[model samples]
Target: MADLKVNIGHLALKNPVMTASGTFGYGLEFADFIPLDGLGGFIVKGTTLKAREGNDYPRMAETPSGMLNCVGLQNKGVDYFCQHIYPQLKDINTNVIVNVSGSSPDDYAECASRIDALDNIPAIELNISCPNVKDGGMAFGVTCAGAESVVKAVRERYHKTLIVKLSPNVTNIADIARACEAQGADSVSLINTLMGMAIDIEKRRPVLSIGTGGLSGPAVKPVALRMVWQVARAVKIPVVGLGGIMNAHDAIEFLMAGATAIEIGTANFIDPSVTIKVRDGIDRWLDDHGCHSVREIIGCLD
Candidate 1:
């Protein structure tokens, strides 16, 4: 078998396959469908300092080849996660990364600090770029200064593998990524759903209640790959490529373009067992190429 191990900072993953946050809820919801240990890691739903009810109804819309969501980082808050969710996750053998989000730097720091207390969670994916939330989220991810401020504050409070999830909505994603690295981000994840909207001509209304939502799935794959490639070259730290990853082929494309690891997002909703399929497919691909290590194909774009 090919060696599928890879490292994101001090945290070591058995493979390069992980499930994206929001798409995977607390990593427990899919327990029956997938073997949790087979995954490199699974980022739980977005957690905040306080529980958010999220936006009104009609938060999801199905696009041609993708889906749009304005879920608004709905969660039961960090306290609930630490008190209730942590116990259930503590025994899991695989890496459990928390997807931390907030409206302010203090919120991010406080949440990260709280998750840091969890013995099972080895890393935190700082979500400074969630477009669905009207208060903060992607607000802090669009600008260099905004990204730096949040990351800097979290770095001081939370000590672990700090992975900042970057927003693709920005003009220069590389600049924002570089700022996160400068502020002590251990790793970076890219292309967190591009902003999109759909119309209901018959009703003369917007499909989603929020009018606009973040788009994911195969439609955004090209843009996601381009951003991942650019950001990977721009940052020295590892880059977790996500967005529009439906199969192992799509995942491999991201790896060759320059992602250290790939996260399956919308695909999980279509097939809960997709994570294992991607992982197995990658192993087969690696072995077929006579590559002993999955790392051999990473950034081998030439």
Candidate 2:
């Protein structure tokens, strides 16, 4: 079989297929459907400095070819993760990454600092799309300075593979990516759900509780592909692509477009075994195309 190994900063992956944060539910929940180690890595749900109850009811809604959610980064906080969750994942024989989110730069740094103490956890994907409470609720990822501030704070404390997850709502995503890189980001994952809303025409109100939510699924694939391509060219670090990648063909497209690795999100809800399927399908496609390694196709587009 073609070699599927790849790297994101210093974290090596057995393959390029990883389950996205918030969707994979700490990686343990899907153990019945697929082997935990079968994945390149799995990012656990978003964890903050303190416990969050998440948004009110009806936080999710169905879109045409995708889904919208405003889950509000709900989790039991980092201490609980470090105390209860870390032990179970430490010996899993695969990379277990933490998705860190917060309302301010200090919050991000402190949460990352705690996760940095976990020996088995090699990376943290900073979710900067969170509202900046100090900035009147503007997301830290929408502007270069906001993105840099969070990364800078986290970089000083977190030390391992620091990946900044970018927001698609920005004007020039590449500029935002460059800002993260400037602050010592090891990698950048992109297209973290597009901003969208679904209206309940019959009820005469919005379908989601937050009025708007991040969109993800088949409908977003094209836009995500374009953003990955642009940011990959702009940054020197590796790029982790996500947003509607459902199968190997979709994953392969991201690889070719310049992503060193890709994450599977919304698709996991439809098929629990999709990560393994995509990994194997990538190997099959590589062999059929006479390629010796999955890396051969990364940024192969000319």
Candidate 3:
């Protein structure tokens, strides 16, 4: 069998297949469908310092080959995760990483610090790039200074494997990635849902309640691949690629584009079993190519 082990900073994944945050819920929700232990890692929903009700109705709308979501960062706050969610997750066999988000630098730091206290949680995916929320989400992700500020603050308080997710709605994504790296980001996940929107022709209004939403699906794969390639080249840390990955072939495309690993997002909504399928597909492809491990193809693009 091909060696599937891959590392994101100090956190090692069995394979280069992980589930995108928000899309996979808290990992426990999908327990009935796919084996959580079989995954490289599963990032939970975006947790904030305080509970957020998120946006209004019609938060999600289906588009051609993709979908738009303005779900915001609706969660019950970090305290709830620690009190209720952590106990159930701490015993899980696989890597249980939290997707941390906040409205301020202090918020991010406090939430991360709390999660760090949990002995079972090994890593965190900082969500300074979410487009769904209005106040903070992607605000800290567009500029280098902004990205560095949030990362720098969290890096001080949170001493775990920190993977900062980057936004695609920027002029120079590579610069943003480098800024995060310089500020002590262990790894960088790219192309976090491109900014997009749709209008209802009849009502002559926007389909989403928030007026705009984050787009994800096969449609954004090419753009995602391009950004992943650029960021991967710009930073020494691992790049977790996700935007519109649907199947194993799409995941492989990301791997060749310089992503150390690929995260399944919209694909999860299509097939709950798609992540496992992608994992198996990657393993089979490696064996077919006579590659002993996934590391051989980490940045094999030519």
Backbone clashes under 3 angstroms, per model = 1, 0, 1
The Cα local distance difference test for each model comes to 0.92, 0.95, 0.90
lDDT of 3 by residue, 1-302 (tens): 89999998999898889999999999888999999999998999999999999999999999999999999889999999999999999988878899999878888999999999999899999988743244544488998988898899999999989999998889999999999999999999987888899999999999999899999999898999999999889999889999898888899889988998889988889899999999999999999999999888887988
Say which candidate scores most in lDDT: 2
Candidate 1 lDDT: 0.92
RMSD of each: 1.7, 0.6, 1.7
Q: Is candidate 2 or candidate 3 better by TM-score?
A: 2
Cα-based lDDT at residue 288, candidate 1: 89
lDDT order, best first, reads 2, 1, 3
Candidate 2 Cα errors over 4 Å, as ranges = none
TM-score of 1: 0.97
Cα error, candidate 1, residue 14 (Å): 0.2
Clashing pairs in 2: none
Model 1: colliding residue pairs: 130-138
Better candidate by lDDT, 2 or 3:
2
Candidate 3: the clashing residue pairs are 217-244
